[model samples]
Target: MRTQTLLTAMLIGMATPAALAGPAADFRAADANGNRQLEFDEFRVFVDLRANGGNAQAKKVRLFKAYRLALGKVDYDGDGIVTGDELIRFDRANGKS
Candidate 1:
């Protein structure tokens, strides 16, 4: 019985982070129309800014490019999209949530 209690506590402790892992605001961005979809054009705007001599925007452009790649990898359902649910799951799996 003591061993059982200890095991249960351990399991709960290990599971706590997963349970608490939910969507976060920073993991998302707004699109042109102010909708929250990870679209290509939103990313391109950053690139365009940099091309126009916005060095600060270049940094953001690179960051978003990396994010886009990472998000694409997580979009397993392949609806050519990554919804909030998908983002949450990806973050939880990566321990970022």
Candidate 2:
């Protein structure tokens, strides 16, 4: 999957999503390998796209910080990978499921 699309997928319940698709859509697009795990580098791109500011560089910085902050919460295994089951659990916990 493209980096941006994957990044966007990892963000399951953001109030202001940069991508038009919802969490399920993003997840599906990212999990192309059928392993049901979304490896995020593109997820970073998705977060970067959500960063607001006039400077592109500033947005990138924000994206990295934000992504790091969020990674742990979603990556339950600490493996730096988010599986479909993980997303579902997260969404349910957040009442977004």
The lDDT leader among the candidates is 2
State every prediction's TM-score relative to the real structure.
0.40, 0.50
Error of 2 at 76 (Å): 1.1
Best by TM-score: 2
lDDT of 2: 0.52
- Cα lDDT, all candidates: 0.40, 0.52
User: What digit string (tens of lDDT, one per residue) describes model 1 on residues 1-97?
Assistant: 6543332222221111123331122222234555555455543442343334433423433544543543354465876555556545654565544
Candidate 2: give its CA RMSD in angstroms. Answer: 9.0
Candidate 1 lDDT (Cα, 0 to 1): 0.40
Provide C-alpha RMSD values for all models, in order: 14.0, 9.0
Write the residue-wise lDDT of candidate 2 on 1-97 in tens digits.
4554444444544422222355445545545565656677645543344443232432544555656645556677889876656656655666564
What ranges in model 2 sit over 4 Å off?
Answer: 1-12, 15-21, 32-34, 45-65
Model 1 collision count: 0
